[model samples]
Target: MISGVASESSSQLLPWQQPIWQDLVRRQQQSGLPHALMFTGIAGIGKHELSLRVAHWLLCQNSSGQADGLTESCGHCHSCQLWQAGSHPDFMVCQPEDNSRQIRIDSIRKVNEFLAQTPQISRCQVVVIRPVEVMNTNAANALLKTLEEPAGESFLLLEAERFGSVLPTIRSRCQRIQLLAPSAEQAQQWLQASGVSPDQASQALRYNPQAPLQAQLWLEHNLGEQQQQWLDLFGQWTQGRAPLDKVVAAYTKMELDDVIHWYAGVLADALKLTLSVAEDQLLHGGWLAQLLNACGDGATLNKTKLITLQRNVQEIQGGLLSGAAHHNKQLLNESLLLQWRALLQ
Candidate 1:
């Protein structure tokens, strides 16, 4: 079965989303809300959550608007109660099934069926299809039909990380809303507000630049310590103070994609240091000095080696994202580490 039936409601907008939210509300108030909207942004910037907020607002039965000129759903209302309970008749969400990345034709077909129905509870029916770029050609084409002839009071909210990745035909049919990540300062503030320690917040941002929510999740998972441990081991291995096999074994126990990403960050920092870039401009600026001291020779890595390693990490990251690393994760990790050792020579 196609996954993603219900959306968790968001009561507040992320700080960075205020302007976009206001613009959307103005359009909504002016009766200019489009039948379809495409929200595009990098991951963890709250595109999906923003869509849910808008959906909740659209589904809200509250007649009395907020005094702040922003309209939010009153949680006590019957429509909202139904929405929160995940049994709202007028709402549906389409996404990839479990263990899959691509949104198949079956899901889009279901969306078509859902859109064919009239609103049962509210003034409109809403469907949210996230990461729309993952839809296969057949699925995209199927969705295009619904976009072309949208049913009465039916709205489609589509999300994708890369706007250019979506089909042109589909792009033309929807109003595009692009989301930008918050500044580092803003992200760090938000993370601190969310109860993460200042140091942890900074480290998380280093691991996940411009994406505060992702950084927040990283902190929640207590992966910051894991990252530091991995970096220390990596430094030791690169310095020939630790065995490659043991380092690889330790990494295999962690999330491979994150491990690769952190490794890429280390290489990037090394390149920056080699080029005499300011420490403040570095991603791992706080821990970099200590890390370099630990890395020894790895810290003074030439730009050529660093760039090559960066490219290798990028390829492995792409493989992970494309689901190509599922079965060959061990091989991929070993190959990357072996190449790291080779570049040290």
Candidate 2:
């Protein structure tokens, strides 16, 4: 497990964060802090950021100074200084080890040990764990004991992008806060302010509506161009202009998982269009229509075929993520590509 002390930062809350932050601050002011607080939201929506801010707020020496407006950690105070220096004794964060993504039982045990000790500086001890769903069953079970009977003035802050995937038993013990995405207009404006073009912002938002940071990074990496190139190659292959072997060779040189995901997005859009789903539901939207006009004919857009393709793509993606190397890379790409080609035909 990776352990660290919480630190004070100059980062301000995003627009989507205001509601939840306000509520937490209100609770703190009322002296109604939850011993275990769960912050659940989509990835890249700043759940961890909000959690850290809350930690700093609770640990700040001058927390009472800002009751009228936005509360902040008095960065000049002793407590804030300790936090800034990463030597704060009252705060701790637990995470998965770099080599092993799983948060094992030993890590949770360490947390249990930390909580057992009296607060070193601040009156309350704080612990933060991110993406807590990565914790194995044993680790989670160990954590449940601490949650059931938290000792002293200790607080546990947990963040999960996929909250539903976390154990229900764990969920029941904590006070949950769900963060929703900002409106489309807000997301687009934020992206534009960050120097993304209108079209690029729209494309990225379509890919992941609740994750503006991910969308911005997607545009930064020029994945929109990559998507276009992949679609073009697929179109050519469908028309017998580009050979399957050539496309497979191209894919082998690029990130395999990303390619699969992009294809999955396109297929998903096509399926939605085939079912006459609302236009807003599509990731590609008008771009999908244009692509279909130039390439796809909806001949292979049946629900069963689309679902099967999605499932297969997810399975392959999972395998790749889990370090699947038993099969030859080129051969695997060729097989997947041929399957896609057949579906298109």
Candidate 3:
């Protein structure tokens, strides 16, 4: 039952999305827009925002009749005003309930009912469902009905982090557009423009890779110093200079999923170093050199061991994301730290 109208901020497009935006605008202008569209990409690459922007354009009162060749919404129109206030009658957003992973059948049923009605103000009705991969089978099946027999002038905009994870039936019915992460240079420029310092921006990109929005979030949270401290502790633990409990204590303060992601990045860098990967190619290259110095050298960092540790971390991450329950968090962190310590031993 989580349903709401998109805010004005959601209508803004990211710079990297310009090409896709232009193409969609052309399709929309030519009356070639699909009844159902699914945007697929890694999280934080602006899939949801792009979808909402299209939704906003579709619902704008001035969009259809504009002779000025404008493809964007007029923000001051009555429809845009309603949308900005989160009370738009013709638009809806469906997502997982708070603190829940799955969007149940109940929500999709509401979506069906919402789309069943005529457009109250705008010329069309639009519904946005994000991370559609999390919809349970019943929920997805319920959505399939709308996709198969779409109501007049109604558009369903869906987003998923992984296209392969979406139901095959859902995929076949929707026009799929895959968004790509921005290049490192483009990401750093965006972060810097957003007020992150150059060095901080670069470091965040290293930690987050091609995901600029996520890198910006990393900077906003001021996690760079803490991340470095965690890396140093990891280096000490691997060298047997710091106790395993000490390292685990520091890491447990963060969410287990985040801790594991950081650990995986470290392992990835170590594996790269073991294979003589150039420094520029490493995700956490800044810390790897110091880590190798602390531990001995590349000779001590075994490639096979790093791969095995990465697999273990990935398994834990997958379980955590899948909502697996009954995990003993502290013990799990301890076990992972012990595995890291063994790399040096």
Candidate 4:
């Protein structure tokens, strides 16, 4: 069994988590903890973080229990120390394998073995399975057995961005908590606290909306800069100033999904401009001025062609991210970019 809690820094519950925290505490007090729980929310909203927080609290020996209604672990406790050291025997985390990106039968078998044993440190064993939907059919079936009749004081914490994709059998076995994005005001505050400037935070929020963590990553990684690079390259390719081979090579080197996301933003801005929509409503509003200055107004844009390209982008992104065993990704990406280049003409 792979044993450890999520990193200590990200395991603390956020301000937006108060409602769910209080609800879980009340549930624990009223009827004890559920054997299995499904933490469902949009991607990058800290669902995994919340799961880690719960696991830490449950396994912490010096924790403020249901009586005190705390949402965090006592960091000084031996259990917490063991967790921080990444050797807590009672805590097992299962995730998709590195290459396949799917939880396989082998991992689930280890979970079964782990669940059969008694807790080594705390009174309970905590198991975290992230993106539970990534479990293959066999792996999901294997897990269903444990969820159906959980043995000992074991708790299953399953995090999923898409609850519907999880096996219905597994979903039925666990108590589900549907987490929502924090309000705009709360998200903005969190962004500012993370050192994002007011203007940039607003732009990120506009770009990503409901997902503060994703927006933060976008800023931290300077994805905007990367997007600009792609935009400029595409423009050059369209104007016959850059070689298509090099452009394709550069695109295939970066993450395809992020490139697709950036393409979607660019296409959306073009669409909005074509329809004479307000600039403030554009997702790439921060880059709108430069985009228009370089790419010209959307007046001459072929809406049908843009829509077709957008659909192709989605198709390519979905194909690449499906975690298949093998694919001709380079050729596929090159062809897609060629199509996009043609559309620019």
Best by lDDT, which number? 3
Residue-level lDDT of model 1, residues 1-345, one tens digit each, is: 343345453546899999999888877876558899999989989998899888878888772233343376777788888878778888888888876777889889999998898888777888899778878788999998899899887789999887886789989999999999999999999999988889888888877889998988888888877877887787677677888678878988877767777777877777777787898887767465665566565454556876888887877776565433454556766777777766542
- Model 2 residue 154 CA deviation in Å: 1.6
What's each prediction's TM-score? 0.87, 0.81, 0.90, 0.89
Q: Per-residue alpha-carbon lDDT of model 2 for 1-345, expressed as tens digits?
A: 555555455235787788888778887776668799998887777787788888887777777623453376767778778888878888888887755656788888989999999987777888998778778788899999899999898899998876776889999999899888788998998899888789878879887776887787788788778877877777677567888888887777887667777777777777777788887787766655564566645544446766787788777765544332244668877776676656553
Q: How close is candidate 1 to the true structure, as a TM-score?
A: 0.87
TM-score, candidate 3, is 0.90
Please say which candidate is ahead in lDDT: 1 or 2. Answer: 1
In model 2, the worst 10-residue window by lDDT is 318-327
What tens-digit string does per-residue lDDT give for candidate 3 at 35-145?
A: 999998887679988988998898899888334546888898999999999899998899888677678889899999999999999999999997788788899899888
> In every candidate, how many clashes are there?
0, 0, 0, 0
User: RMSD to native for every prediction?
Assistant: 3.3, 3.9, 2.6, 2.8
Locate the minimum summed-lDDT window of 10 residues in model 3: 318-327
Where is model 4 more than 4 Å wrong at Cα? 1-5, 63-71, 286-299, 319-322, 325-327
By TM-score, the best candidate is 3
lDDT for each of the candidates?
Answer: 0.79, 0.76, 0.82, 0.78
How should the candidates be ordered by lDDT, best one leading?
3, 1, 4, 2
